[model samples]
Target: MNNRRLPSLTPEQCGSRILDAKCIVAFTGAGISTAAGIPDFRGPNGLYTTGKYNADKVFEIDYFHKHPEMFYEFSRDFIQILKKIQPTITHRFLARLESEDLLTGVITQNIDTLHHRAGSINIAEVHGSYWSASCLSCNQFIKNGATLDWWEEQMTQSPRSPVVLCPHCGGIIKPDVVFFGEPVRDLDKAETMIKSCDLLLVLGSSLTVYPAALLPQLTSASTIVVNQGDVMISFRQDMYFILSDLDAFFKKVIDFIDS
Candidate 1:
């Protein structure tokens, strides 16, 4: 982790950063929600790095069919986190931006629905979320609470539990999340938001993951990056770069906006 601090830009400076842009887009990741106590998927204490569960095997579509328990274990914790966590200042700031007509939409890699919770209506969850589940066999959608109840029942019944069956047709049930091998749910909408934006603000991502990572580059707008550490993107000198805690930085920006 790089500890070197980049000079802080004032709220006026940050506000001016996007003043000329008509359409502003925000790209977010796990880091954006970390302030709300959600662990990032690939961060130091993340599922992959901590090795509590194999991210690749658990998230793989085929592998999930063979061993659904692993995914359930992961989902159990994630669901609990979702239940307890609140959206941070950054999330609220973005929502406020939309209200002010300064932001067009949000494109997030996070599966957590903090952006929505924070009151952002124009959001695209590129990686999907735990809010909804789907039946693989029947194509029926189930609410998250219903799926959790069914999963709990399975755990108590038998060691070799039956596959999650759709209530409608008795077919396989899966979360709406985009698994390792699965294609993203709404690529066209995501691309449309990115391409149409005049300013792109990327937050809390290392910019390593593809498809979602490629979005910032697709924007012809001026791109601003705010993260705790170094980013992988090739940002121009004119583009704003704020290397600091996301919540603190955004709080400052919000306060500046209020003033």
Candidate 2:
């Protein structure tokens, strides 16, 4: 998976570069979670390309406000899939990198909470996550919102799948995930992490979605982009792209690190 526009690096080379760097930050997206049964937006079998899961309705803020049920139906399935899956090898690799102090933190575009599940402590969930929900009508009035277990139980209750509601106000409950129209959650912290890091690993992201996409461009750090398919970002002298499977590629990196 070499791109004609720029030179590509092997997983071992990537590993060597990572080990040489003092500060490292990883930017992840749905591609990293696809191995854990979550679908990415641009992949052939992804949510947007597949006939299932209407991208426009599932993520659009205005559509959710008008017909929240559509989003709920999508969520019902998403949560069900999420409950049965485990974090992928790529997820564990990042977690291990952080635990060993070789990596700074993870800045993720995924709302799946896989990074947290993998035991990465310092994570900036740029897209927000399903792990927390707020009362839409009350405008996050509940200081401590319902736990994830509560949210799951409510979202999956039988008879007819219902939109999760805020227990306090009986208003619709919205997962903290940033919708298409909403601003992403943690740009400031993600920027700080990226700007200060000596190396940036762009994993499983298309780099098409702004301003998360824009974050990588802001830093002059050595950047590596790894994804199976085509990405939007162009190649630069300090930047490298490895067009390969996320888990397979990371497996080599981790193996090299141990050796």
**Predicted model with the maximum lDDT:** 2
Poorest stretch of ten by lDDT in candidate 2: 141-150
TM for every model, in the order presented, reads 0.83, 0.86
| 125-234: candidate 2 lDDT, tens digit per residue | 88888767788898764433334455577866633636877667778888888998998988999999999999999999888888888888778889998998877876
lDDT of candidate 1 at residue 56, scale 0 to 100: 75
Query: Deviation in angstroms for 9 in model 2?
Result: 2.3
Query: For model 2, how big is the CA root-mean-square deviation?
Result: 3.1
Best by TM-score: 2
> What are the RMSD figures for all models against the true structure?
3.9, 3.1
Please, what are the lDDT tens digits per residue for candidate 1 over residues 1-259?
2323334466568877666668889999878988999876787877777788887787898998788768877766666657777999899988988998989999999877788778888878788875567888777676643333454554345445434556788666777889988888667788999899888889999888888888787765777788887877754444667888888877767676677
